[model samples]
Target: MRYLVDLGWLRSGLSFSFGEYFDPENTAFGVMRVCNDDLVAGGKGFGPHPHSDMEIVTVVLRGQVKHEDNLGNAEVTKEGQVQRMSAGSGIIHAEYNASESEELQFLQLWFMPRARGGAPSYETSSYEPSQMVNHLLPVVSHTGSEQVASINQDLTIYLSRLERGNELSFHQEAGRRVFLFVIEGELEVSGHVMETRDTARIQNEPHLQLAAKEDTKYMLIDLP
Candidate 1:
């Protein structure tokens, strides 16, 4: 149901630079590929960059980031908001902290393109924190659920926050894989303790059970 990715395990080897956090794998997980949790210092940012055949979604947890693309799209997404960019065919974009003094923390997700070529598009929305309590709150989906914004891959992203002593379960499809990232507080997942920023990649299980040691925050990614 869920594998535990200890923060201590990943931070030991990973490095950071250019306002980027890299978590490369031999092969990205299913249709859902890259997941980078980044923290951008104020007044510093990422310049223009190129990407093609990928769906990039940015979810801010704190502070704000300004996004600008070659197609004349410019916007700023704050905490509680979701920004989706489809780099179909090809596109050049840049992201930086909008604030001059506050550090920005956010998650950048990349999904493999479902098809070869198409036009590019961008969409954004705000989600209330309460929506994630006791259950998964779909933030982005390939089919585009009502509250969840649309994307370009057959995957889903959900955010959940559980109060102290709360518990939750997640079920996986026959051949599906799941990734969980603990953002805050403590959790006992499958009997192991996971603290903030720890992640878990789980496969070969029908379901998972998570219990909150305190008010815990986390994300669940279901990849196709």
Candidate 2:
């Protein structure tokens, strides 16, 4: 992981190359391109930017995020909310903290679309924090349900909170990949211990066993 601090107001822990940070050896994982854990000071954020053929997802972890886009979409997403934007052909958007005195923490992820040159679109969905207790709540998926944001990719993003001593299991089809990120607290994934902000990239593992060492909140992505 790489740490990024921008202008004293934005701090980020990046899992893949983004912005001015580039690592040829660690560029991307499957179709997933960027995973940035960002903490922005109140009233600060990125200005309007352009993107094309990218599946962008944002999960607000604390405070609120104000999103504005050239597609005439403007909204505020609070904690537990998920936002997805498909920059199919092209799109321009900006994100900022909604509060003037509160810090905002969120995870911004980018994925390569299955095919490019479609119409751009945006959507938001939310789940109650209680719904994730010891359960993997699907927040984003290609086949989206009412409570899940749809994206132009063959992947599903799940959020979960596990209490100490609680365990969870996942099984995937053969030849698929798994990406795990610890958002808070600690967990023992398979056999490796992961603390806050640690990530695990797995392939050829059809089954995974996770146990919480402490009360933990995490995000897991099943990628093709």
Query: Which regions of candidate 2 deviate over 4 angstroms?
Result: none
Candidate 2 lDDT over 90-141, as tens digits, reads 9999999999999999999999999999899999998888999999999999
Model 1 ranges off by over 4 Å: 1-27
How do the residues 107-204 of candidate 1 rate in per-residue lDDT, one tens digit apiece?
87777878868798888877888989877888988888556789877788899998899899888888888877888989888788989888777788
TM-score for each model = 0.87, 0.97
Pairs clashing within candidate 2: none
Q: Provide the global lDDT of candidate 2 against the true structure.
A: 0.93
The whole-model lDDT of each prediction reads 0.79, 0.93
